[model samples]
Target: MFVAAALALLATMILTIVRALSGPTLYDRLLAANSFGTKIVLFIAVYGFLAGRPDFLDIALVYTLINFVGTVAVLKFYEYDDSVGGDYQEDDY
Candidate 1:
């Protein structure tokens, strides 16, 4: 059962990669990348269980946190277009 789930996750990850590569917009690609990261976490957890290695869970948790932070940072960068100098200018909309 675990093996089957792992395989399914792998397939879904592949599809996510394809979507990330061929997405029509930046947001679509970002969504796909986030999904791919989630699938990777699931895959790692499942594989760890199947292989009887409990340490993998810790690694997966850490990876999940990193992925979340990275996604947020990228979104913030795109949204504000700000830099470390704090010279943010409002868009003239």
Candidate 2:
């Protein structure tokens, strides 16, 4: 059962990657990326349980926090369209 759940999560992660690549808009891509991150957290936790390693849950939690922060930072950068005192503009990229 655990193996089946892991396989399903892996399949969803693949679909999420496809959506991120082919999204019609920036927001759609970002949403897909966020969803992908979430799936990763779930996958980690489930795998940890299946492997009987409780320590892996801590690693998954840390990853989840990092993912949330990284996503917020990216969204903020896009919202501002500039970084480092307006010296760096989005179009510059």
Choose the strongest candidate by lDDT.
1
- All models: lDDT? 0.86, 0.84
lDDT score, residue 33, model 2? 93
Model 1 clash pairs are none
TM-score of each: 0.84, 0.82
Candidate 2 lDDT tens digits, 5-30:
89999999999999999987676788
- What 10-residue stretch in candidate 1 is worst by lDDT? 84-93
Error of 1 at 72 (Å): 0.5
- lDDT tens digits by residue: candidate 1, 1-93: 999999999999989999999987676788999999999999999999889886879899998999999999888887776453243345523
